[model samples]
Target chain A: MRDEFRADLHIVSQLLVDMAEAVRAAMRQATRALLTADRKAAETVIAQDAEVDSIYRQVEERVCDLLARQAPVASDLRAVITALHVAADLERMGDLADHVAKTALRRHPSPAVPAELRKVFTEMAGVADRMAEKIGTVLSKPDADRAAELDRDDDAMDDLHRSLFAVLLSDDWPYGVETAIDATLLGRFYERFADHAVNAGQRVVYLITGEPTA
Target chain B: MRDEFRADLHIVSQLLVDMAEAVRAAMRQATRALLTADRKAAETVIAQDAEVDSIYRQVEERVCDLLARQAPVASDLRAVITALHVAADLERMGDLADHVAKTALRRHPSPAVPAELRKVFTEMAGVADRMAEKIGTVLSKPDADRAAELDRDDDAMDDLHRSLFAVLLSDDWPYGVETAIDATLLGRFYERFADHAVNAGQRVVYLITGEPTA
Candidate 1:
């Protein structure tokens, strides 16, 4: 029974890695579409969301199955429960990517934003992408310290987000309200993506410490 | 052992009820702040989030303890896991309320959103609040039919969100980018809140039906 449970735990970890990677890829596509205004890439991200959603469902079912079949205890139970939350977080992150991509599709052509502002948005996407990668590492390795380090990326993203808006509010912006809304939504999607990644890292810390940290 | 497990299950149900009520109250506070731009109400919602987070922690710990100690099987295992996921969702919904209240505080003097727009937002919040309540009932009762009905509310919220945005965009309002961002973010928060509540209800359905549905 113990060996079987351990094997099931290993399977759960692998599934989490898969879910995280799938979401990271979707985010990458979404961000690329946003930066380049690539309609095809945006459409691809939207199209592939169903794949991520299905994987999420499978992971949830597997975790429940493991609990029913193997009856995990203590830390094992925490791991299974954490897996469920982690999958949900990743799935929502996927939805955020879809949001960005759909918004990009709508805003494509006619140059909605200035080059400098576009650079900042792209950089913010990079921050979110790196955070997503760090989340994958945290899930696979359960490294609380590494998770904490990656967790602070949200603060930096927040600073960039504010700067991005300050520029928009300044007299330099000429593209008008439509462009501003697109930029604002893009900033928010990246910010929220980073936030969920932070939440994932925080969960790792909770799992390691057996206490929920801020 | 079976009877002891059932007792543990009962405790889990009670915890779900408690957490759900806490989140409902928080949503009410957030709505009051939005409607009235009441700083006091916003502060109350922000302050209450800590309690919501703490209750989330307590529920997680207690559920994990039960899983570890009692070693629930089959449906019992599903119930505990569902409770864990649902509690996390409720906690997140509380966080949304905090976000809404914080946004409300910043927008105080309530800068000129039309009555129609306000009405849609109010309806969205109400749907979210009701959906959260319904999920709690489903958790305590394990009623699949009621869980199914929650999805209808989600559809309603989405419709309102669409109409709200159309009104915002079609208007020739001169308030500029700030108001647009505020309106969009408010709409997104309520939309996502309803989404999470839908997820919670879906989880309840999965627990009872042993099948995944849209």
Candidate 2:
């Protein structure tokens, strides 16, 4: 029973890492769709979100089963709970990527991100991608120091998000209100994706240290 | 021991109800601040958000304690897990309210919402207020029928959100890019608040029915 429980915990940890990787890929493809207005890429991201949701459901069920049958205590219990939280954050990241994809689809054949702001969006995506990668590492290895690094990546994403607004509100912005609104929401999506990644990292930190990070 | 566990479960339920009410009040004040440029109201909501966060932490701690010590199975386990999920949703609702308040504060002395869009915002707030109220009831009583009503409220909120974009994108929109962006984000905050409330309601429904709601 003990060995089986340990194996189950390992599976849960692997699932979280897989979720992190999937969300990273989704955002990457969504960024591609956004930058180039690729409908197929957008559709692919939108369609595959169901897979992320399914994985989230699986994590929840497995956690519940472990709690019921194995009754893990202390750090093991924390690990189980943390997996639930991390899965939720990763699932939300997937949804944000889906939102980015839909935004791309809404303006199909025309790039959702204007040429002037593509650089910042690209930078934001880069930061988010790095953060997602770090999340996978932390989940897989449960390293507090590595988890802490995501906060800096989040700050970088925030800077990129603010820069997007500066460009949108710039005097030379020619896209007008409709595009401005879209850009604002898209910026928010990327920023929130980074925020959730930070949250997932914090959960892992808490699971390891038994202390919540601010 | 069983009796103690039941008492803890009861306390968790009450905490969820309290969170619902607190979030509802915050949104009400946030709307007032947004419409009338009431800086004090905005500041009040902003400051009181810590209370909501504190309550959320309390919920997490209590739920974790329950799960660890009691190792509740079946319905009892569902109740504890649902409490965690609902508390998260309510905490997010509080954050959305805080966001609304901050938006109002950002335009201090100037109404964040324009005169033309006040009615729609008011209606949105009303629907959200009702949804929050129902959330409190359902959390307290665990009635599937009452919990299911939040979906309709969410639909109402989505309609209001759409109308907001319609007005913002209309040809006669007098607000420039900055105000438009603020309104867009504000609208999103309210819409997401409703979405979270619906999510909480569905959790309650799942608790009662042992089935997920679509």
Which of the numbered candidates is closest to the native, going by highest TM-score? Answer: 2
In model 1, what lDDT does residue B108 have? 78
A1-214 per-residue lDDT for model 1 (tens digits): 9898888878878888887898899999887887787889989999999988888888887887887787777778887888888888898899889998898788786444568698788778888888989999988887888889765788889988999989888876776676777788788888988888888888888888888775
Task: Assess each model's interface with DockQ, reporting 2 decimals per model.
Answer: 0.62, 0.84
Looking at model 1, give its docking quality level: medium
lDDT of 2 by residue, A1-214 (tens): 8898899999988888889999999999999999999999999999999999999999999999899999888788888888998999999999999999999999999998888988999999999999999999888787999999999998898888888999989898898899999999999999999999999999988988989998
Best by lDDT: 2
How does model 1 score on DockQ? Answer: 0.62
Clashing pairs in 1: none
Model 1 bad stretches (over 4 Å): A109-116, A209-211, B109-116
Which residue pairs in model 2 clash with each other? none
TM value for model 2: 0.99
| Candidate of highest DockQ | 2
Q: How well does each candidate superpose onto the true structure, as a TM-score?
A: 0.92, 0.99
